[model samples]
Target chain A: MCIEHKKEDIMKLVPLGDRVVIKQLVAEETTKSGIVLPGQAKEKPQQAEVIAVGPGGVIDGKEVTMQVKPGDKIIYSKYAGTEVKLEDEEYIIVKQGDILAVIE
Target chain B: MCIEHKKEDIMKLVPLGDRVVIKQLVAEETTKSGIVLPGQAKEKPQQAEVIAVGPGGVIDGKEVTMQVKPGDKIIYSKYAGTEVKLEDEEYIIVKQGDILAVIE
Candidate 1:
């Protein structure tokens, strides 16, 4: 666990159309082969769990709305999202289309 | 190296408008601490060397062409690009807008 305390109780969880807010899950220490990844070599997974989902992305130059909601586990591209740190909590803002698949 | 024989022949190296071709660099075996990342947890960086660049993305629905051309090093979103395996070589095709920055 991080030295910083984990804070819960999110109220204002509204995402813009087609935009989604995700809280990254802490990656496991051991790999599938039971080997540990070094700090420098550890690549952050592109996948994240959806904390808040926005409406669908803009359509025809106008916001069309969204499909997924909050609490959805999604797999996104490794290169997607703009990093954001809110009160020591790291979050990512990404467009809906950027998400590739939803993990069931 | 992949088991397949490496083929090197240049006839057509064209990327569609706003699109670029890139050859992915192999991730190093060791980390900064000289530790290796497990294969299952290896996260590919969202960066690639521009092989062929298309014209700028379609402007107002028409192809606007591109700013960068072949042989440019670019950093893109990890989630970007549709992967393609061509003759034993993996290549990614992505729009110019998806590129984050050009590596100097």
Candidate 2:
């Protein structure tokens, strides 16, 4: 999903705590073994666009401030989040800590 | 190692960021099939005593406060930490977030 994916659709799925909901910007991925990898191959996607961000608050006894906002392009660590399915759309819910960098 | 293992000796090692150094509290562990597991086995030990705690401060752009102090017996997630052998004494360094519960 990109910036034009409609904020209203993403707002339907609210994240809890310091979690952020993101949709992968996928590309046809190929593995080092010369095989086409599956969509969920883990290596397939690390880049995403933020769909929604949780309200920053105390999480696990630590003050967390959500640094990334919706529509921000970001890169997350491989295998960092839980894949969530909502209404036929797949989203990855990751803690703010799992986000590696913003793509600017 | 327990608190009786000498706090002075543990002080030699200092953890960085929100990491905590811990030593496993071991027992003769058996697998689901009833085979005794080795000391390094992941299922063998989950209980640990805090050997050292890092100073509370900003880590990874997040403010972290060290909650578990040295000598606090805690239960950590299995396979959660990096094992370090400092001067022949083995210790596991884990982020405080990986600590599950403290033993009262």
Candidate 3:
């Protein structure tokens, strides 16, 4: 469920299957016109950065490898993924398919 | 966004990126006790058969490939994919990562 990265003291989670752990991008609180948006007015963030990737393995005799790796910014479906909190930090665990595109 | 398959008269839809087109498995209308369950009582089918697959291409410099091909039975997340209607046939467009497992 959770894996510790030796390089960083922060605990890293290892997602299973084609799942990827990501941190959601925060929505802007103010508009360019200098108008502050209410919490309810802000849309759900669909963009996120990949924190960890699952190990691609054989499923039903087919080999599945991960496409995106750590530090990759990605766009995902609005309703996809499971939310989790670690060390008071929020994250989402989503499958690679749920990711729509990788942002360069 | 729709592609035609030459082999079958049925028009095959090609999913983009890691997307996959699937036909949901029908749920049993009758219970094991022989009681007829109402349509609303039936749970959403999570199992589906792959109809067509997308040509996985470059994403953020990563070359992702299709893991499951046509005719493969798979189990997907309950809320994953978008429902689509084609030729009066209902189908779902889901990402390969949304697929939990391939049923053998």
Q: Which residue runs of candidate 3 sit more than 4 Å off their true CA positions?
A: A1-8, A31-41, B1-104
Classify candidate 3 by CAPRI docking class.
incorrect
User: Local error of candidate 1 at A49, Å?
Assistant: 27
Pairs of colliding residues, candidate 2: none
Looking at model 1, give its docking quality level.
Answer: incorrect
lDDT of 1 by residue, B1-104 (tens): 66876557734457766677887655456767989864335656554678877765555565443555678765565677887777776789887656644444
What TM-score would you give candidate 1 relative to the actual structure? 0.44
True contacts kept of each: 0.00, 0.00, 0.00
What tens-digit string does per-residue lDDT give for candidate 3 at A1-104? 66633445677688987789999876556767998774445556566799999996764455666778899876676788999987667899998767765554
Error of 3 at B88 (Å): 34
Listed in order, the DockQ scores are 0.02, 0.02, 0.03
lDDT of 3 by residue, B26-59 (tens): 7657878898764545677688999888777753
TM-score of each candidate structure, all chains considered together = 0.44, 0.43, 0.46
lDDT (C-alpha) at residue B1 in model 3: 38
